[model samples]
Target: MPIQPQAAKYKPESPILSLGEKIGDPVHAADFPKAILRFRNDRWAEAVGLDHLNDDQWVQHFGRFQPLEGTLQQPLALRYHGHQFRVYNPDIGDGRGFLFAQLRDHAGRLLDLGTKGSGQTPYSRFGDGRLTLKGGVREILATEMLEALGVNSSKTFSLVETGEDLIRGDEPSPTRSSVLVRLSHSHIRIGTFQRIALEQNSELMTRLVDYCLTNLLQPAPEGVAPPIALMRQAVENTAELAASFMVAGFVHGVLNSDNINITGESFDYGPWRFTPHWEPGFTAAYFDQTGLYAFGRQAEAIHWDVAQLAVSLRLLCEAEPLIAELEHFPALYQDSLITHFFRRIGLTPGEREASLQFIESCVQAMAQTGTEIDRFFFDWRCGDPRSPARYAGEAWDKVRMEAAAFLPAGTRDHPYWTDDAPCSMHIEEVEALWSAIADRDDWEPLNQKVEAIRRMGEAHQPRLT
Candidate 1:
């Protein structure tokens, strides 16, 4: 909106420009019927030096999509292809969203501000490029909850209610519309590589690999091929992501290769649900009849998606090296799962084998007794530093003794730890909150829920690393 805005804290960037036009399309944002600023992520906005905008400016930039100073002169709707439900599709890309801007965050990490329902691009094939207000709300909740549980998730940057009526087969007709923006480390998807490799463009793939190594990841260690280092990083990052989802009891609902980011941050929420208990086959999307991306199979699904990345990387280097790094996913996931569980309960990891057995026993107890997963984590925070007594006849008895050997962790002194119940976002709770906004236009419940989630995050002292 401004050629050179007022003094800002973070530096502006357009690093994606270096990749050239092959990566995306230069596009314009749709002029909305109305620009109603429904949500503003001040916490993260300030980090990216965007908190300087007032309400009107916020709507003008995010809702109307004006070019931000020192960032992209225009929006870029990116291009890529992916496997949707294991069926490879080559025609899809950023149909509804585009990379709007980029900047450094408070932590000095490069961040991209991308949008959903901003407008239609050449990629918007066979469908309207609009996000329902309900979809926007759900994404906000999903990201907030996942972040609180220590998952590496994109922050829901902004949501602007665009006054438009849209008809959809999935939900009732004449639903409201909105634009959602997400702050993420990268918009580079595994599908991006698929598109490049599918073209047999090894040179292009090499350029991308170098780009990721320079910006998305730390420099490759001496004597290591960039492709090999990328495989190792993606594998470990993806394993940690899957493990966090398991520990948080989150069901992403969609595990397509296009949905998976090369940086391993989870975004693009749709038909997501939080499980009530440890149901291994619990499905989040109603259409997932096969339970391919079910609660328990998430790790396996992510591992498969990473394998596709390996196939793409085959263009750049020998498959042997990629396969070698890919082979580490299972063990990396196990370690990540145990590490996340221990962090959830405010305990340090002790023996690797012991931690593994302890987490499994806890899961077994959850499945058999039907304890709400969130409550279990909340109740057990800082569980007796001394060896907890074994239950006379309980599944968690062995787990209790095993956890006792690990020291307590985290700043769990928040009053939230003493509450009668934990802050949880099961599907029912989500629907009830949405009901108020849909029926009476009351947003208080949604506001309060976000605050509660934040408090829970503070209690856990979530580690972004």
Candidate 2:
């Protein structure tokens, strides 16, 4: 076999240097696999400002950055059709997004550096091709928070505060828009193949499968089960993704085939949420009225989404084999759940029958009596041997009281718990203040919480064998 150029000179970077290079400099700071987009404005600027190019200088900026040194910067528009809310929307292709380049990081790992909100293309259709600044800001937060929460997520590269006026609802007025650039392993989605399948374009689908296997899933060796084998690999990827989301308490909000990826990594961030409580019914999408994408139903949603991807592949193969591959979801989810359940209780290494029973007890306790999810963990972090036992009194009253600071008082279950509910007004005010931390637009509070969570993660049992 021929050797690849970069691999020939491969020298593993010390983990410290690998991580340090991402912190570029003061003008720009890199966050691990992704970096921050320097803020600019032109709706879709001619330059990424990597060289600090002004508007007129962007054309020079464009050609020079064409193929970033280590990432795949191919400029081919990918094909895909998807069911948007159960209706066939067969006309999606990168739309306004493009994979600009791929590069290897200091870690010697190849990562894709793609830009979204970069403006229009042949697939732009009838849209502004501009992303709202608020959405851009939210995506940055979602990626940062989810990474800290230990989910396999796309890292935010640069959030260019492109100083262009754009109009959108959910905002007080027309606001300055932005172009968000992200870095990841791959941007290939299940919908990418789904598009070719819907066209009955098997040749294209085969090429797509080959491309993925060569680049992302080359584990099966050179001459494995052919293109169809990739279909099986894709199934496994989706299953693992569903399990990860379950463990992380993440609600993807949109499970459309196009939003799902063959690699099983969480890619797009939209209407997503990290649960504050363990309620199975919690939904991040205000519009997910059908409950198909609720917190508890995420695994099933992923299964259904993957099945839709299989439909495209089935045009050239039997359904039973693909369906069998899809069945791994439940078992995978169960194993992942039990493992996480133990960690939440601070138990690890040993797997006794009693451990399972204890986990079941905790789940039942939380279910029987509605408990604040974040508070349950916060109480565990209280550093008191008596902390867990306090929940035994007054039917879990102490747990509720300790959690009181974290939940909205009005949301408490008192018949008189109105806006004017009577209590130690000072305590009520304090709770209101701290609870609002989750709703803040600024990063100071969330940043502090992230640091604390990181400290906790450092002390946890190793996640891998």
lDDT of 2 by residue, 1-465 (tens): 000011223221111112122111111111122122333323112122133445334322232233443333234344566776666787776665666655444334445555666666556688666666666656765665455444556766656555567776655557656667675657778777676776686766666666677666655555545555776777666766676676566778898878887777777776777665566898888888898789888888778888887787786678876777677766665666655544433434134444445445555556666655544543443222124554675545543443333212111222321222111112233234334432553445434543444444343323331
| RMSD to the hidden true structure, all candidates | 3.6, 11.4
Highest-TM-score candidate: 1
- Compared with the true structure, model 2 gives a TM-score of 0.71
Q: How close is every model to the real structure, measured as TM-score?
A: 0.96, 0.71
lDDT of 2 at 109: 48
Q: Which of the numbered candidates is closest to the native, going by highest lDDT?
A: 1
Off by over 4 Å in 1: 1-8, 385-392
The global C-alpha lDDT for each of the candidates, from Candidate 1 onward, is 0.88, 0.54
lDDT per residue (tens digit) for residues 130-209 in model 1: 99999999999998888888889998999999999989998988999999999898999999999999999888788899
